[model samples]
Target: MSDIEFPDTLIALERAAWEELQAGRLTVATANAVQDAITQHAEAAGMSRVEVEMALKKAVRHAEG
Candidate 1:
């Protein structure tokens, strides 16, 4: 795991998305919106999509565990 720092906004977005998933409120539209927000955040942060996605997966796994 690289020590890449993501913006707080991105972290919050992931947390909210995960919460939505846990609460079974992750509709397709909501998921799409989250993806779009993540992509925009990543771009603004100068991070690649792959990097952001991998980090998000790691965060989700960590949250689940």
Candidate 2:
């Protein structure tokens, strides 16, 4: 077993979320669907879908890494 410590911060949270997604806690398709939903919500609120997707991709990579 590894005894690695995770950092604490907004980035860390994003990383953790990513790790969960990678660990079969979430499926890639499900993540895409969730991102779609988030995009819809953000669009309704006049936000940027591209930005949201970028963040989502970043988190996903962290989890996958």
Candidate 3:
């Protein structure tokens, strides 16, 4: 649903983080790791961190079945 090429590892991390957030188990380390991954992905893709993060979240949280 998105044009962004999200890395599987990044998606996994974000999914895990999302689950943690849902269960109130989110930690600083996990959140930071997701942010780091997003930053790296944005740099590698030559896109802004905001754009990459938005697309990634949509893909992860709002994907169609």
Candidate 4:
């Protein structure tokens, strides 16, 4: 992963997706499937898991800003 974070839109989309999963509208199996899809996409895009998490944090901060 590069030093750069993910774009705000991506982070927001991820956060919303996560919240929906947590609320159980998305089943655990379905959420895992979605997460896997996201992970695969991120890996293909050259982002590490840590980088993705950092990006999410950065995105949240940016949203507050």
TM accuracy, model 3: 0.96
Clashing pairs in 3: none
Alpha-carbon error at 3 in model 2, in Å? Answer: 35
In model 4, the clashing pairs are: none
TM for every model, in the order presented, reads: 0.63, 0.38, 0.96, 0.42
Candidate 3, residue 42: how far the Cα is off, in Å:
0.2
Give one digit per residue, the lDDT tens place, for model 2 in 1-65.
11222223333444555777668696666556556565664576576766655665555464553
Candidates' lDDT values, in order?
A: 0.73, 0.53, 0.95, 0.59
lDDT for model 3, on a 0 to 1 scale? 0.95
lDDT of 1 by residue, 1-65 (tens): 54667667666777777788899887776677668877886788898977877787576548554
On residues 1-65, what C-alpha lDDT tens digit does candidate 3 reach at each position? 88998879999999999999999999999999999999999999899999999999999999899
Count of residue pairs whose backbone atoms collide, per candidate: 0, 1, 0, 0
Ranked by lDDT from best down, the candidates are 3, 1, 4, 2
- The prediction achieving the highest lDDT against the true structure is 3
* RMSD values, in order shown: 2.9, 9.6, 0.6, 4.5
